[model samples]
Target: MSSDKKVRQATATVTELILETFRLNGRLIEAGDELVRPLELTSARWQVLGAMDRSAVPLPVASIARNMGLSRQAVQRLAKELEKGGLVRFAKNPHHERARLVTMTEKGRAAFAAAMAKQAPWAEALAEGLSPDLLSEALAVLRALRVKLEGHDG
Candidate 1:
């Protein structure tokens, strides 16, 4: 076979894999929605909370959006809703006058902990047959793709 033929085959396989990843993302989001339902949280809210929970210090809406691969406007909307729910509070940002830092309240932390507890079992069950090394490799590949995509606008 020709080298050009091999390149085209590889490109086709990568395209198929990307599409499969999107399908899996939809399923994962659905499962996530179910997992956090008991905590009165949707997958979007849970993700925002999770990001704040992971951060050592408070972050602005833009930072949260960047971390979550979401738009700043979308994160701002979630932050506003979370704030109204008393799950998060905004603080003055020393660096920026208008951009406030978002912090999870104790209530938010408790909810996140509860959701994490439930996620532990679900994740373990899902990983029942998967190899740790394989999972790590897959994560690395996905991260690499995300980095490349982030650098491209279209």
Candidate 2:
């Protein structure tokens, strides 16, 4: 292809990627909302629970925010609700003088386990025709692109 044609194709690809990201984000939000409804949690709150479940050790609210790609204040608020629900508990972080660590409570673990059990079949069906290789490549490419977009030394 000519240089001009290549440039146009690249631009179009980027544009499509951006638009599809927005579209998929909406779907994900909706799916999350629906997924957590029976658990009586919002999508954000559910995500906080999931973050706590994934942490090797109790993580500070800031750390969870960074991991979950959410604002600290937002996660903190959701954490507060989760705390009230007896799903997560706060402990003092050894590394941070002022930050409290958040960890999943047994209730939180049960909730996550139950939710995943219900969701597994749906997820499997969604991926029924997808190849593992393609998924891995997509993840790698997206991660690299995100790093480059962030002005990181990717």
- The estimated TM-scores of all candidates read 0.93, 0.88
TM-score of model 1 vs. true structure: 0.93
What is the per-residue lDDT of model 2 for residues 23-54, given as tens digits with 9 covering 90 to 100? 98899779978987898877677788888778
Best by TM-score: 1
In lDDT terms, how accurate is model 1? 0.93
**lDDT at 53 for candidate 2?**
77
Clashing pairs in 2: none
- Look at candidate 1 and give me any clashing residue pairs: none
Error of 1 at 43 (Å): 0.8
- lDDT by residue for model 1 over 1-154, one digit each (tens)? 8999999998898899899999998999999999999889988999999999888989999999999999999999999999998999999999999999999999999988999999999999999999999999999888878988899534
Tell me the RMSD of model 2 versus the true structure: 1.8
TM-score of the candidate numbered 2? 0.88
Top-lDDT candidate index: 1
CA deviation > 4 Å runs, candidate 1:
152-154
